[model samples]
Target: MKFLLTSGGISNDSIRNALVDLLGKPISESSALYIPTALYANPNGPAMAARLIRGETNTAPFPDGFTSMCELGWKSLGVLELTALPSIDEKCWLPLVKETDALLVEGGDPLYLCYWMRQSGLADLLPELGRETVYVGLSAGSMVMAPSIGEDFVGWKPPTGGDRTLGLVDFAMCPHLDHHDMPDNSMANAEKWAAGMPVPAYLIDDQTAIQVVDGVVDVISEGHWKLFTQE
Candidate 1:
């Protein structure tokens, strides 16, 4: 499977160019699977996020031109609002993932999102999706694609309990690059995490992304993306 993982959305023109380089020629259509439920805790957050996802918000949003990717054919999907567990499989889960070309998960609280992913059986369902779909995880989305999550602000931190992640991707991903909102010394902490690790690691920024195709991993863009490789 081909994966395009990013720290966050791209708003810079140069970054946009870089993304097109990574994505290669646009397919006839690409479906965006937006998991707004992952960001549903705040009353206004989900709705507010929709506009941003729909390209109706954000001062310097991911550029108006990219909308053509959606307009010309890319179909954006995160339309259902789910709150209950049973509602997941029946009402929102199955249909949302049915015919997707790519699953684009936006950045949100990884904790809550991961919780929902487990509860909703998405963790189990993911590999099945891999049979045909390319999973594009951004920020919190990307972090959950790993075996275990690093300490991150937007996602849930395990409380007295531990659950190994879905383990689809062999590496752990940390988002936000050198941003102050994260650890005081981000690279130092990342290095510490990698000290005894056996697989490659990646610390990404909003403008950066990495594409994992077949078994080869390549730097798709580095505007703000950095790969720790050993952590």
Candidate 2:
């Protein structure tokens, strides 16, 4: 599986280059299927980011959206709101997903995203499609891919059902650490959070991302992040 797990969306030249290179094709030749379902449950955010995830759209109140990709100098041909897809009919959404070179998952509520992923059946299709495409995850998008989104994991409470993550990654991620814009997150809080986690945790900020290609893991960022664990 090739994944660019970022605290924020692709925000720098290095991250964009890595995604393009991972696709093994120039951005012009590649297409993406933008998935913004995580925003569906946010109280203050938009119900849908934009009808189209393209260069000329406004993200509005949402922290990230099509405009995030545009700002990073990247582009995509397909844009989808996972919330809009018919949960019972995979046929309605599968083709576009298969046609894309990348799948960009947005940030917000991790459990909410997970619930829809399972409901839409994308959760099952993902393991197979992931082998052939780049999975770009931002914040909550990155958190859901982990084995579990436990207590204090990713700076949020676990969903009502407990650790309901996709289990794609071995560790949990607590993103937005010490981010000046996110006042509640800090290194001190991260340290306290890490000490109680059952597994290793990654504390990342907006400029930081955890890039996992195949089985190799690397920390890529213009800012600082830390690996915290009871181990």
Candidate 3:
């Protein structure tokens, strides 16, 4: 699988170019399914989540301010909404996933998103998607792809869901590193958190991305990032 995991979603030209490249085509020719499942998370869940709710997350068409990412100077973007996993069937979202050229997962609450991703069966279905489809993630969107969601970074703990992610990547990512937008996210905090994780942990800022092509990892960024592991 291929991924363009950004801290703040397409922040600059470099990130945009990478995303377009990952799409294997111009943004104009490709279509994307914007899954804002993370935004739909309970706002009161975590500290960073609360700040997110107050920030760009409240924006329309995408609570996480998807205008820049979706606009991509390209084709149209579609929104996928599912309030309750059990209430909705696969037919409602599967067909849309099949037609899109990419999947744009927005940021919010990782725990909240995971619950629905699994409950709706999308989690299982995601691995089956064709290699041609790009998996673009922003903030919590990117974090959920890791083996587990570390609460120390965002403090957004699930009321009931487990920390285990889709495990698409072996490393746990702490997005928006040293970002003033979210005060809770700082270099000091992230480094401290990364030290304790079982797997490698990457702290990436808004201008940075953790790009994964087939299993190889690359840190693409215009800002700061750190990869911490037990030596």
TM-score each candidate: 0.73, 0.85, 0.84
128-217 per-residue lDDT for model 3 (tens digits): 888888898988889889888765634445566457777888899988777655667788888778887779999888788988888899
- For 1-231, candidate 2 gives per-residue lDDT tens digits of 588999867766677778787889887777777777887677644634552243334533324322365334345555677666754476777887877788888787898888778767788888887566888898888989987776664333334577668988788788877876666679998778777767788988777888887767888887778998685
Q: What is the lDDT of residue 148 in candidate 1?
A: 68
Clashing pairs in 2: none
Ten contiguous residues minimizing lDDT sum, candidate 1: 63-72
Query: What C-alpha lDDT, on a 0 to 100 scale, does residue 160 get in candidate 1?
Result: 41
Best by lDDT: 3
Q: Distance from true position, residue 173, model 3, in Å?
A: 0.5
Point out where model 2 deviates above 4 Å: 51-67, 70-76, 153-160
Better of 2 and 3 by lDDT: 3
Q: In model 3, how large is the Cα lDDT of residue 12? A: 72
Deviation of model 1 at 159, angstroms: 6.6
RMSD to truth, every model: 4.5, 3.3, 4.3
Candidate 1 residue lDDT tens string, 1-231: 456666764434554554455445454445656565555554466564666555664322233322311222353444433346456446545766756666666556666667777776766677666545666666666766677665434334546445345566788776666665555437776566555444667766665666676757766554555456642
Q: lDDT for every model?
A: 0.58, 0.73, 0.74
